[model samples]
Target: MRETSATRRGVLAAAGGALLAGCSGLDEFGESSDEEIRSSRLPDLTDDGESQPVVVETMPIEIERTVLAERVQRTTDLLATLPMSFGADDVPNGYVRKQLIEAAEDASEYIQDARTAQSRLTAMRSLQRARSEARFAAAGWGFVEDGTTETARQSEHEAVIEDANALRSDHAYLGEDPVEAVLFHAEVEQHLAFVAENRYPSGSVNTDELLTVAEWGEHTEYARARVDDGRYLYDRFRESLPADAGSIEETLTTAGESLVDELQRRRSDLPAEPTEGDHELVWRLRYRVRDAAESSARYAGDEPGAASTVLRGAEGLADFLAYERIRDRIDDGEQFGVEEAADVHDARDQAVESVRTALDESPRAGLARPVLADAAQQIVAADEELARLRGTVRPARLDDPIRRYVTATARARSVPAACQEVLDTLTQ
Candidate 1:
């Protein structure tokens, strides 16, 4: 039987509803309460009188390990580059030295925690705490100053102390480790006392303009450093998961599906033929879709994997949808790329291929077999419908363009949920 757009949209919508029902909220990274973690049950493989073969994948461990390694590397790099001594005098005063030592100690403790962390969730939370400590330690050095008179030097010292306190408070997340915060505050107070007694030489005093430049430079550098460190940590965190990590692929796929649904909800607000006036909306949608796909792909762990394939499909679909919108404008005689239709066609093909590949490589064993089979069937049906829509041209009012759009949108949304279903079954 030929698949009409109406029939296709209905099927896709039903599949999406079913997929959404099975998916959980995307709040996995929050700091789990002790009670929650303690109450969480490990997977049980025994059923009836038979022992089912269940394989525990090491992707989670790999993810944890990579995060730890990156944190260690970043903290070590920052410590090495830390300005232990400031001002005209090369040697740091006792107060400055004390703060540096405290920072070093906190960093050391963080390294130990990262190394000893037993789980991925634990490692992530630990890393966040460690980063906060490192930031506070780094901010301490920004207080160092040189001024000509006792009063001027005292004023500068006071300002630095104030800024340090503000910076520390800005990093309240690090307060999760109270000892680290207490030590940081103590160092600040001690440093201020030492500065009161020992002022810089008159010759070494910096002008107001120079001081302003230096202060801004210090703040800018600190912000940039933190950003760089965060990127390094997060990139490694995402890259660490191995392809075989239990149900990670399914988790990622479901996330992608959710993202697509979110996009559809937003797209509904746009006119049938969005114009250049809607450029901001289009760009925002594009970015959201890209972010969603990238986030989902991270769970794929390594390259050339199922999650990666689904990510590719999601991205292709995004591109297709954007181009389709452009094509809609072209139908109104607007100056748009004539090649958009071809681009949409190619993107759809890529999405179909990637989805099929993910389904093919997905594991179908143990307790997850039935669920996986059901998901596979749904994906196959969606894939078939997408294939049928592939050759159709744009702006045909008789074929119901809105229904076709919904069908395509629904299929994209369904992929992730289907992928997640496989993971859910395995974990359960």
Candidate 2:
């Protein structure tokens, strides 16, 4: 798990990224222009004969932010899986978790396939540099090396998917809890699509701006590819999860839906217009920055892996439940009797504490805040609800507490209603 800015966690996810456009030979987004700048007061160059071609570039900044989000999402997906993998069997849980993590690492190798606009531009610049006599000139080492590397690395993707998937399916009955990898997969895909759509313009945008967007595009493309490969592993892991292990699947499903909704809101919440460009040269920059910020909707969860953290935390609680269930099975006659009500309360309290710890640790692992927030909120709510349910079970015989168990389940057995509430405000 990656460390997060806990200091900033209190802040509602930032309203959005900063967007500005200008031409100081740099776009308001802080990207360099594509035009080979020349100092001149040429009458034809300006409406007032006072301005030069100040092409604005924005793709660089956008790409930088987008890539960061993706990297964070990728890491969090794995870290958040821990608590969920727990069940009666710690060894299998650890084994499966390791497999998932390893699979993610394998996916990462190809995530480089997608480059941001900047990387593409860098490639172009390197080519130019190689041809130039400038002391800074040096050809990007790749061209052919990159292709070979891709070829060598590419085959691993499909193989990883196959292996991971098989493992998950094979282990499905282990009584291990789930981490809900599908939601993670879906969100990463959404981010990939978002990044792809923001492809920076080449001829119309600044050189640096073009490079930035291209770099981001490449990166997302890589992520998309890796994720696509990861599907096999993640899916298998989910499938292999013990059917009776825990209720993490349900909890993660709910959290994922909420996070996805928020993602959608952010996607739609893009500024009605790209930042206003001061000049035609900077228009592309404005577009790229908006696109970058928009794409961020995928990776920048108010929480890491946004909804994933909640599921991960719930997995921990669910695993504990599974452990209790196993103990119950072994006890034979040691049922949920009123005499053991105190013990049940203790178990419930333990579950709550475990969940809280999971929430705190989840964010530390880089799960997004919004996701963690939703999860935390849900867990807290669920725990409270369970307590209320336990009260109902009081005086009742152990055999009769089933109804209480069903009723005391989290109010949000599905996606959180607040998910929609939050999404209604977030956007492109």
Candidate 3:
């Protein structure tokens, strides 16, 4: 993972050049007016001649392969400029340099694999992941370099502010009380303070701990990714959404109240103290659910999908809690019993059935296609992991068995939330 001297020089040279090239403008994000939003096409979640509106996944554009190849080549060219090896002393930030090399190497591997990827979506995911990682590493190197002065750093921060503002504005244009967009909007403001004032926000990222420009660049990309994710989710649910403000607000209010009630029931079911392992894990999960409930209470009445988002989060917490609960019960060196194996198999079967049923019934049943598609994808992953479980796990290794079992169960448990979210979304 360590960079060679020549590699370090090449990476720094490329990144420095990028710094000089300056930040791109916000025009790429595109602007949407209220009129445009009202007339937007409903997402194509069904097919011609289809009796049922199945879980239609977002399809790649026809030119995706060509575009992806070009992107991969660009990423490859950027990393190819780096030399093969370097000493720690060659760079001021050895930790960051090592990370840069690792990221570059990973990007290279992804680029290679992407060339022959069977699935377009798979290839796109890998390429985007690689690009983001490279950008993060490049930013790290650019900010830590001695030549990047305070003026340069401040300029980069300003660009990030513009990026955040543009993303927020686009989210606002959705105008259905996009919960994640609002939350991310608030988050960017907090991060802005962190970068500009050296104050830490409640979020995971601490801007003060890292070089200001590096943190700003990293967070800007992070926010961009989050905003993109939210857009995709909303698009999935927006196909059948009512156009009037009163209907949207009423649905949100009812869903929010229901979500809060559900959260309360789940909270009440949990033991006051951990009956098995460390209390901190349980407490953390509890707090997360509590936080989601609080957020649901605050925005559910106004935000279009806030209740559903909170409910989904609460379900995820439950899944994690399930994993931790089982993990603590498992003893090191103990053979994973037939009973546990049966449980895992049962969970897998039920999850698969749930996803299948959702997909099959969605057209006639009015289930949300986005949630069903998401659940189907998760189940596919869980099935893949479960398939490899038998010969791979060792009786003496707790970590392996724990991982295999918990991963399947957690993923399986998460599938049901899609139905709940759909129900909440449709509530009047």
Candidate 4:
């Protein structure tokens, strides 16, 4: 019933009065009716909607652009000050520290690029992402640093609470549309609520440190970025709404059908029961595939909110597929101690080989520009993790190594699926 014919009826009309009260002058946008959205025809994806006015909404964050840019640069500089490499003695978790440093560097680049960006909207989005990444690095560093004091952590906890409160208001202005945006909106809302309750979301990455200052700050800032990103995407989708509903509907229908079929295939491929050495992991992945199938099936017929269901299904399907690959290779039962380091090393080597093989099997000698670009990024990430694991893997702490191994393995495994999706999109 949720994915009934009403799904697309008012995809853009769900912005009720309560939600619009906080928005400045955006009330008229929320006042649109289903009939109005349906009747106002616009160019489809292929056509350039140059005739339409550019509706670039204000940046979700209230901070001035220059100030935020400076903060991002400062965070990046702080990260740069740390030694290029850290032993176990230098940091609590070298793998996580390395990732944070890389993330900060990336944020700095984005902030600088936004300065020269021609589009105001694009620049705002880049700035929001940069700021979020910088904050994440700053907060996560507290965990990696050994000498962090309780007083400093308490200060960070208070700052994070403030940040979380600000994000709740900022998120209110984002319109509910495009299944992707809606899903992200819900996640942001949930994360914010968790912050208020001083708890972690279910199945969160930060399971151990539910109330830790560093973890709380990192989680909150990550949610902040999601809110900004979701709003940016919703605005983009609004501008790109096709004048011809039939064309858009047909495309979504075809994609949905493909996703459903893939979901079924993946479900069938999954082990009927949990296997040894990966009992929990296998079942977890199986349930994920099942959940994706259920979600896709909800939007079986092209209905109003079917797009949301389908989009949710696609994301779940990707995770399910990636986890399936992970389950096959991980055997914690066999990995008892430091003596099994060879197995971990071998896993890394195998993951690298799989990525190279995926690239080799690419269509047109991998000349497809989009596929090549995506695969190249995944390859680089895998290589970086591989190198980091090699340098930081100590017998004293296998947790970090295992985490990095899985991260690299999952990225390598997902490359082929990503490639296929790109090819399908191009063909369509």
Candidate 5:
């Protein structure tokens, strides 16, 4: 027989009573016993040992509704930010322009459908449809083969596509179907691969080319931003899934591995020599250091461990930047000028101080505190190494010192990698 809400409630209440009795030793004074607990907790079974249906909580549906509403609202806001028209000259291809316009229109319709969806299944379908439209939009933008690329426009298009895919994935996981979750994940990966193929037809940027330092710096910033968004979305989606959603964990782990592989590729492709006029790297480092300091301060009270990780990553990145600055000067055959050395020293000192302050102010509890303290010490050591290298002239062979510094800051670089694992665990 199918259990009604009242029957389910009675069963749960009795199980709770048994638990309380066991925990508080109140069973000694009552009729509660092991057999009673088992009877209450187990489902009624027929002669063939088949259990009856049990009414589950509405929490899963509620989570779906909440997430759908938020996603729809976010999509609406994104739509508003996109330009209504790309002038004839903007794309330089009439067919591409038409495709983009159609994709935008389709996205708007799908989002509307999602907003009005009456069931979880309908909402999931609508969100995925909208995500497809976003992907189409990305492809359309990617087809502009002859125009000057506008970074802001390209970034916005990419953001919309990524956000759409993320929303759809969240909805699928929340639906509690393992197959759907896996399929949705695969769909996202496919779209990402398509975007990559289209955006960089010749593969990744060539390291040996005469690219500006600012260009590479922008790429770093973009990658960091994507990581930040991924972390936040993964946390939210994991929370929405059922406790027993083991498939979600597996999917996320696979995704993390893919991300790690991509990051490794990019890191491996980094140029050994500095690009001409790449002074932007220094400013980027300064900005990242300041951002990390602010984040540490913001998270210090409630999430001291997270704050510590941020500080550690920032410290390592700062050291990396310092090395780059020195390398840039050496590549240019300039003597490590006194003024340039002072600037590098100041940047490193500021970063070190920020991390120290974060560690000092963060609560000294939990396993994270010790790990963070160790990382802080490593940062100090890195700073000392930089000091030793500061006044020295350019060596004939620079790879050795750079490799040494990379090894030294390896822990800091691993912060994001560790975070990816932690994010996957949240599903468990």
Candidate 6:
């Protein structure tokens, strides 16, 4: 149950050089248009046998109420200090950050107005890159045969997978909102894969390389702004982190899970021990603490046996996800109290609590939102159910009920804004 400190650190520090290599073009992320990203999620209903229409969520409630009217001013001071941290190199990455800062500077000028809406949407789009693209790649690993030559070869799939290694941030999954937000996210991810699979690079039968990467330049990094430019998306996204109290905690929890998953995915290639990113890796070790707490809390009688059984069953997801800790995260969400989800919630909650203190200290105080813990718990749970269904490898054969169930469940992400407001009032 004890993961060596060295093994743990390996999970946090990714091969940044390889993972971030191609991020350089001045117009890289800017090339892709929003329509392209949104269009991808439109379900290839070409298979009329059983097709689904493009489903987008809509929340008519006012988001301006999420925070205090006066609190808007508080965020301005905070946003001013953010862009400085994104590194001059990655600064000009995109226009997201630039717009966020502009919105922040004009805080008094545009408090709770359309300006906030515009800038926030821009920021959300940047964040979507992680889930819609990076995650699509990482999760696509699910498509490869477990014990094939492809697994050992590190082929084109690796390029596709590695290209999207940034999916774990808060921007990627902003707790459900207007339908456009969810649709854009789902579409971008869909497009990343759709284009990768269909487009062929010039002068190459191999067809695996960046054959159509240029085409995505607009929808992706190409059309994006220079890193140091006022428009740097990444910098702004991080700067304007939610700061809604527990936002930072959630980001750290997510980062921690991401670190572990990232490392675990490639741990086989690491040295016997790891050296950097120890900060991020600690979240994995906390899994044991989570597991033990759960055992004590639940099946205290036959708990050890139950834990062992559950643990063994989840090995595939753990390793594939690159971190055994993901099980802990997945366990906590304990969605619908159904068999698959409830199994992992206990441990995940413990892991979230474990990272509480330090995460609060991070800057983008906004990222410190309470959703950190809950999000980890829920994502872990949803992923578990998805993983359970995946283990069967029966996507093509899903029953009518099953298909609707999974897709509907996935689409049912938007929490009514009114519900959140009610809870916010009670808690505050």
The prediction achieving the highest lDDT against the true structure is 4
Minimum summed lDDT over a 10-residue window in model 4 is located at: 15-24
**Backbone collisions counted per model:** 2, 44, 8, 4, 0, 58
User: Please, what are the lDDT tens digits per residue for candidate 3 over residues 1-428?
Assistant: 22233332111111000001111111112223321211111111112212111233222123245656666765665555444553576455666556566666666665664564444544554455455445545555554444444355456546655654554444322234434322322223333333334322223443333344444443444334333433443343343245652224344445545655554555555544434335433333334334433443344333234443443443433343444444344433323332223333444444445445434443222223333343344433433333344333332222232233334333334434444553544433
Return the TM-score for candidate 3, rounded to 2 decimals. 0.48
Of the two candidates 1 and 4, the one with more favorable lDDT, higher being better, is 4
TM agreement with the true structure for every prediction: 0.23, 0.23, 0.48, 0.34, 0.25, 0.21
- Ranking of predictions according to TM-score: 3, 4, 5, 1, 2, 6
Candidates 1 and 5, the one with greater lDDT: 5
Q: List the residue pairs that clash in candidate 1.
A: 253-416, 254-416
List per-prediction Cα lDDT, in the order shown: 0.35, 0.31, 0.40, 0.42, 0.36, 0.27
Evaluation by TM-score, superior candidate among 4 and 5: 4
170-209 per-residue lDDT for model 1 (tens digits): 3221222221222222222333333333333222233443
Task: State the lDDT at 115 in candidate 2.
Answer: 28
Per-residue CA lDDT of candidate 6, range 1-428, in tens?
11222332122111100010000111112213322222221122122211211111112222233323323433343344333433335334344323223333333233433233323432222322312222222212222213223232234434443443333122343322222222223333333333344333222232322212211321232112111111232233334434551222233233234333433444344223323333322333233323332332233122112212222112222222222233333347422221222222222223323223213332221221211222233322332333334222222222222222322222112112212322232223
Model 5: per-residue Cα lDDT over 1-428, one tens digit each: 11122222223110000001000111221223422222221111221111111111111222346656655654455445445676787666565466456656766777765565444534444555454454445434433432223454456546645654554345333325432333233333333334333432222443421121212222322332333333334455566666776545444444434433433343444444333354443333333333433443333223112222222332333333334444454456643222223333333333334333433333321211222333334333433344344223332222222222232233233333333333343234
Ranking by lDDT: 4, 3, 5, 1, 2, 6
Off by over 4 Å in 2: 1-165, 171-245, 279-285, 296-363, 368-428
RMSD of each: 23.1, 27.2, 16.7, 20.5, 26.1, 22.9
| C-alpha-based local distance difference test score of model 1 | 0.35
> 3 or 6: which has the higher TM-score?
3
TM-score of 2: 0.23
Q: How much is 21 displaced in model 4, in angstroms?
A: 46
